[model samples]
Target chain A: MRQDRSSVRTERDEQFHDFVAGRRAALVRTARLLTAGDTHLAEDLVQAALTKLYVSWPAFRRADNPDGYVRRVLVNVLTDERRRVWRRRERPMAQLPEQPGPARDPATGPADDALRQALRDLPPRMRAAVVFRYFHELGVEETADALGCSVGTVKSQTARALDKLRTALRPPGGAAPHGAASHSVVLRQGVSS
Target chain B: MMDLHDRLDQFAGSPAHPDSTQIDADVARGRAALHRRRVTGAVAASATGVAALVAAVAIAAGGIGTGGVGADAGTGTGDRTTANGSVGASADGAGDGRVRLVAYTGAQPKGFTIDTVPDGWFIQTDDNYSLLLAPDRAKNPGPNADPSRDPVYDPQSFVGKIGIMLQSKDAHGVPEGTTVTVGGKDGVLVKSRPAMTPDGSQPPADGDTGWELYVRQPTGIQLIVQFWEGLGLTQDQMIDIGAGVHVHKDAAQGVG
Candidate 1:
């Protein structure tokens, strides 16, 4: 509904173009992470989000921080575009789950493999929460604001998301409790905090 | 103190730049939508909802595979506690009760209702596929952006992508225990360890295998049942829910 974007009187379409052109890669990457590294699906998600932003660009441009508006759109598209499927025709001749470790080839790369699995293990929302919070380092309030929720909600999502990440990344065994919603677990790269 | 999460989050990436064609294409889509209407006073948008559904499920059901997945029907989707006791619920509202499927309004054929998804949770569906999105906020957020509009880019660039495999299956994996028919195809249900990966590469040998239920629902379409991690339910639990996969006998008539 570009018409909807036309409806908004404030933000110039040129300004919006600059805005989109600038953030294109980031939006795709974020969508990629949310879609568990599915680049094909990730592109679709980004396209969907851009369309939404185009519809609301005028109104959103008037509001504070249009980038945040678009960011919300990107995240929402990934979260909302849930029914994406990739089909495989092969019967169950023999199947293997992709290793949590790096692949033999360099293109797939070790970091990419590990990171992909870790991200894939997260629930969509939790994944969004993690990407938005930790990757973007958005504050609870900012994350909530971008996501159109309260700060408290952001806190709990972050906490729960951290727990899920821990579960996925941790060796298959028992781990400690995630404590309470009031606190958040700050996970570092090689060493977990 | 360093906790499990801290180290996990720190699982850093070896950054390499990805091409920007998709961004260009996204921009083109938005601009085309805008110019189409602006130039022609009409907009013929690509509602991939239904098309994507057909492709997603059909291709996904027949997705690339080199092995059979071991269905650990005996154990869990993740940590056992995360199932019942874990997965902290929203303290507000009526609490973490079961979700109710509200109305049907996707691009799919008419007259179908699955289980009740929670409120606040948005529905993302096509003719053959569907997903209940729990917003990063527990409040169940709405769709991110309007499909018909152009997106404003983030300066940071499209750095990553996320993939989700929503699977449903009986104890035996697929076609054997439970069946779900969507669209018009009687898809042969198959469940095996999905070879999912992020970098466009295959997964390792030891990753947790998902229970999949494959069927042909739409015209020339198949269905694949998968979820985020594992669905903590047992074989019995999955069967219980899978029993409700609504199949319209008449609609599924021509499906092979």
Candidate 2:
């Protein structure tokens, strides 16, 4: 029993170990972003998903797409958490996420700051859909899968989130902030309201 | 689709991974649990009772099952006892009705509706932080000996309250099963069994010592365990300790 036990255990755990070694970083990063820069909560979410994966290892091992399975588990845990009342009761941490220092594209300019602030101010659910779609750049279906909702919901939420951002960041006079660049987007997206 | 795709892709540099060491450690814990359960030595009756409670728990947990407690007696208690070191022996002698045990403590200093609790009660690891509980009832909400009525919901049905109920129970660890009468009805017992090494309980010719646990949730449905070969504590002692624990319901858990 001793001789065979080592072999048997290795056979059982090999796939899981490989998956973690290869994909752990990506999963952690996604969890980090989803948690809005809370590294600690992100860690908890990743562990929770991975722990569940271990419990259901038999099924997960044979699944066609294990990464997707893991991602689905992560998002499911998050949304389930959102709906639970006790989750609402805990005190939020006092730490602040290191804000992305200014948009990388100089041409995008100071307006990007206002737009980003507007986006961050949205409700968590809407923000998640928007961030997954725009910032994370996931497909509608993928975003739906991650958020455990339908594509149509994602589309509408992203659109509404965008419209709100545009309105929030819009210069009061309906003019673009300096660079006269706002004129360029106004014509492109018909933002002439 | 195209516009949204553009935005999401901008940050697709790559997702970061958690440390490999962390994942490995968690996997190790899970595998260890499987082995620890394997080497346990509970007696046949207690083992049988544990199996029944597990089946009931699985049902309460919303998993596939044969649907009732009758199947527990039919299972092979010997093999199962060795598989799960503890015996679950908390079944009720009471008639059909629902009973719940909720414990609160001095944790969460900012929250209200909190009460003080005794020390040393072991909360199930996952549930330690949750203050709300939804105790799922086993298939046999009452004693198998008396089969007159059935309950409507099990603890599994109390899904939304997992975090809160779990926390309250976590604050106080249960060492023995203590029964009490609440609302003038016979209350069930709540208790815990301490950590036992793999070699502690070995059945003599298909017998070994094992700890006991009893549970009935979402009201009625009780399970009692007897560890291997009578070497461990009796079902009666388990109940005595279980009956001593106290449980109170919250508006969230109590709500329909």
Measured against the true two-chain complex, the DockQ scores of the candidates, in the order shown, are 0.05, 0.15
TM-score of chain A of each: 0.67, 0.62
Fnat per candidate, as a fraction, reads 0.10, 0.15
Q: Model 2 over residues B91-201: C-alpha lDDT tens digits?
A: 331232212123444243221133312122222112221232222333335645332232112222222122223222211233354454432444443322221221121
Question: Residue-wise lDDT of candidate 2 within A58-168, one digit each (tens)?
Answer: 888787876567767777656544333222222122233455422442312222344445644665567677656655566788778867788888788877776665566
For residues A1-193, write the lDDT of model 1, one tens digit per residue: 2477643434345565666667765666566567766656666776677776665566776878776777777766664454222222211112234533323423222354545666776667667777777766666777887778787777887777666665555443445555543222444554221
Error of 2 at A177 (Å): 12
Q: How would the docking of model 2 be graded?
A: incorrect
lDDT (Cα, 0-100) at A104 in candidate 2: 41
Question: Model 2 off-target regions past 4 Å?
Answer: A1-8, A83-125, A164-193, B1-20, B29-256
Q: Model 1, stretches more than 4 Å misplaced?
A: A1-17, A83-109, A112-115, A171-193, B1-24, B35-256
TM-score of 2: 0.41
